[model samples]
Target chain A: MKKTNAGKKYAIFFCQQIDKNQDVNRRSIEKEFGPQIRFFPIPCSGRIEPLHLMRAIESGADKVYVVTCPEGACRYREGNIRARKRLLYTQNLIEEIGLERGMLELIRLKAGNNYTVDKLTRELLG
Target chain B: MAHKYHILTSPTPARFKPITKAGIIAWEEGCLKCARCVKKDCVYKVYEKRSLDSRQMLDSLDTACMDCFRCVQNCPNRLIQKSINPLYKALGDNYWTPEIIENIWNQAENGRVPVSGGGYHGPFSGPGFDAMWTDMSEIVRPTRDGIHGREYISTTVDLGRKLMSLEFDSGGKLISSPPPLVEIPLPVIFDVLPWSPGGKGINLAFLEAARNTRTFAVIHQADFMTDMDEYVPNIILFADDDVLKLSKEMIRRLKIIELPDSGNVMAIQEHLKKINPALVIFIRFRLSRNASVRAAALAKEGAEVIHLTANENGMGKAEDPLFIKDRIRQIHSHLIEAGLRDEVTLIGSGGVAMAEHVAKLVICGADAVAVDIPLLVAMECRVCRRCTEGISCPVDLENIDYAWGASRIRNLISGWHNQLLEVMGAMGIREIRRMRGEMGRAMFFEELEKEIFSGMGIKGLINGK
Candidate 1:
């Protein structure tokens, strides 16, 4: 499939435990997108505070996405659940400030889905 | 010993961007992207400075938006809108309301009394503590400097038994030795949380807060760690079955100990006292239907201190549960009738969520109150009870930084202390001890409504007259 718009800027914060491999494969996405996308790996999605998401937008990312393990599947047990609440809270906060709610997204990764970081990035970007 | 008690406070900022009450909605697909776009024309520059918090997936726009609605008005495509944030509305439960949680969060973060800015906007009376109004008749008095005034209002309270009468020998030096007493600078103590994601960090935080505020924290003996030795003075170990196992040195180090009320509660108190004569023993009992009778019996049995605990919502565990205030009143009056009210200290716990509650509970006959949930709320707990379900805390309380947690709790206690002083000063009382069981200084809605409207034909009309 064609990659997302080259001009749109996107930032992805993915939980480190989501994939079996430690490597996030950021270089491939950067090579194709040419720095239009940025990747941040967090220990757990729950570690993502509302301030971090707000700061990302302030730093010029047009869209921010948080990728985490599916509900009740997190190794830390409820990190993803909490991450979802924080995402919705932040979304509401930004929406109040006259910003589009679509700028922020939470992507829950299913177990054994065989989804690649590049594919997820492309999907979020699109 | 002097009556001046002050809580050292410092500002502790929130780690996360708090969920705001309102959010704006603006459609971007149909944007004209005009040179004078409504977004750019924002007086607060909310749109221009809009940013995403990549870590939390939060947008700065919501926090930065001043709720001016100018963008909505000027949007050529009419795509801008504003509404209350559902997430903000969803915080906390019926007992621990969202506004209460937010107020505690603000107090903890800033170490300041929550001034509503405008005048009181809430109802005149409701249920529980809300149904009673304190006499702020002294508000018109010029000497009403409660928190920061030159004149000091004492919040100090004493624990343990006091002799009703004193006797002296023929010799001037001869006198009866007074019972061991423990005094706290504040009229509040840290009670065991009803439910928590247990960890050493949380316990240490409570202990540290108790030490900082010169109050006590009731900790289960099993939860106590050896590293907590430094805070031994501020710790009240609640021994269930571990009383005999505690070493003499450990028992001696503790100033006060609590034993569960059982058939042999007096024997337990006696055995513990024999182990450490200096230790002030507290009989911890659940508030139930017969709680007042039990409390009176305990007092008459020479119990030095009695800790009556209610449910999380301050209701007794019964078919028809009585509120904490009423239960405390019953216990207080029963003790007074038995002439044992002056002998034993009564510490009430449960449903003490706010600073005003400290005053209300005291007026209801408690010597002091032990708080549980407000401390958690100070540490940013939403009271979601996910921890009770074995789920990880949304705020990650299990691994919380003890220093930050302690400061937050201290800040909360500080706010409560100031509020207590405000209530006391407003009642023209200089000491918290005098505020205890002073029911005349407070108005109960049931009593007032009955007195004013019972005889005006309203009762008969309500009965289908």
Candidate 2:
């Protein structure tokens, strides 16, 4: 899958299991990245499959992102692990199929991470 | 029994926290005696068991309610009015709140690890980490024991270097240093997640799990500054700073400290010089090629460990899944070339998503791996991706059932542990430590690329990795 134009190229941030507690960080992410990016919260990252990633690419997403909790910090513990393997497989598939692999990315941001959202956004937009 | 926490404590830094004193209580006047109250069996128990009058409930919800919506979910009559507690909102400057953590806790509890057959309701992949996926097609066979195990399967990994060359005295007696570091029983730890569960219940689960398994966990200093400080046997705290902002005694209790790899090695050296603690100093760096060079330098300069990662879900760095492993291998090989390979501990996080992947990573040269998204997935997270968009996340963790959440996590670990043992059995390795940084045993995509790069380009492309 390829991401071409910056306009039609929609980027999204998918978060799973966020609630009132995460609002603090969610607000922080929102405050830093206005409405340019869309957010999708899931029950857990493990529930995400390669099909979902591919569908996202097929669904007009210039780029798709998964903002999971820090490594080993998933509520289910393996949600992030399962999601990562799926992503890794997709990446390898991208290489094998001769497609651009930069279209999909997964990140493990925690509730209290001190990293700036702007830096994250910069990398995402690029 | 010197805990890892003892070696990594630093004074807590200043942080913004939101709180509210409003009571979600109800006084006398209106009484329908609704048998099913939302808070009746709510895990957080923000409400009293006694029947509340209308005025009392209205006057009280402002503060007592955490906005968890437990009452909202269980209210039969839907009589309770609820809203976000503003006071709690003020605690976080951006997104650090007890509520967010609670939500995650809820997700980990249920909806995930369904009993094998279930329904998945969500978007394919909308945004953020949802876009990333891990590969797992190796295991075609299935047995309840996880990896064809009849007995026990272990997941412990050695945390230090192996002898590049042991020196011998003139008498021919081999001389050995203290082996450099320790070993944990598990391949990974809960580590410090961006979010955490509330109360001592969940914390106890992690500690008990670690202790039972003889594994390590990275926790906040506040989790055990004193009361639980006694249980600091296997924790690695983030405190690789000067004199530790915490008290000296607390610092003394720590064994390993995780500091950011700001590329400033001197600061680490300087800190070490002051505290002079025997505990190892671990530098946390981004999962970039540049950081590998820094790791090499640190290893050469006597650093004990290097923690590298690609965000939480192991995304970014190289977008190609095959390339991601290649990058790790490159870093591992670079360190080997630097002659400090065996001396530095390499802990990798991000993209480490499966049992086979764990083995593959170890073969690629990581002492241990960390995970983020899997935990969420195990907790029943459906990567709707609309999370960052439109505010989605179905089970809505804000009002989670703590006990249920803990059980769900336990189930997930059980599932993964079974898989780990299977890989170990297939590799024919009895001890997990033997598997660390052993690249010779497994396979990589590049080698496969070389093996069948031409004759079947298209077919090879599909089955590449």
C-alpha lDDT score of every prediction, in listed order: 0.81, 0.53
DockQ of 2: 0.02
TM-score of the second chain, each candidate in turn, equals: 0.91, 0.58
The digit string of per-residue lDDT tens for model 1 on B1-465 reads: 494677789999777666666666424435677724334568887777776655445567777776777787788877556666544665776777777888899899888898855589777787888889899773465475587778878888899999998888878663877889999888788888889988788889999999888999999888888899899999999997668899988988899999999989899888878888899999998888888788888888889999989888888776536889988988899889988999999999988889999899999999989999999888888787767656545567888898999999999988888988888888888878988999988999999998777667664476434
lDDT tens digits by residue: candidate 2, B260-368: 6665664764565366445556677666646667778777766677777765445435643423455577788898887878777888777554444566677677878
Per candidate, the number of residue pairs that clash is 16, 110
Model 1: CA > 4 A from native: A1-126, B1-3, B27-50, B61-78, B138-142, B453-465
Model 2 bad stretches (over 4 Å): A1-126, B1-154, B161-163, B167-176, B195-205, B220-230, B240-243, B263-277, B316-324, B376-406, B437-453, B456-465
Clashes of 2: 110
Model 2, TM vs. native: 0.49
What TM-score number comes out for model 1? 0.76
C-alpha positional error of residue B259 in candidate 2 after TM-score superposition, expressed in Å? 2.0
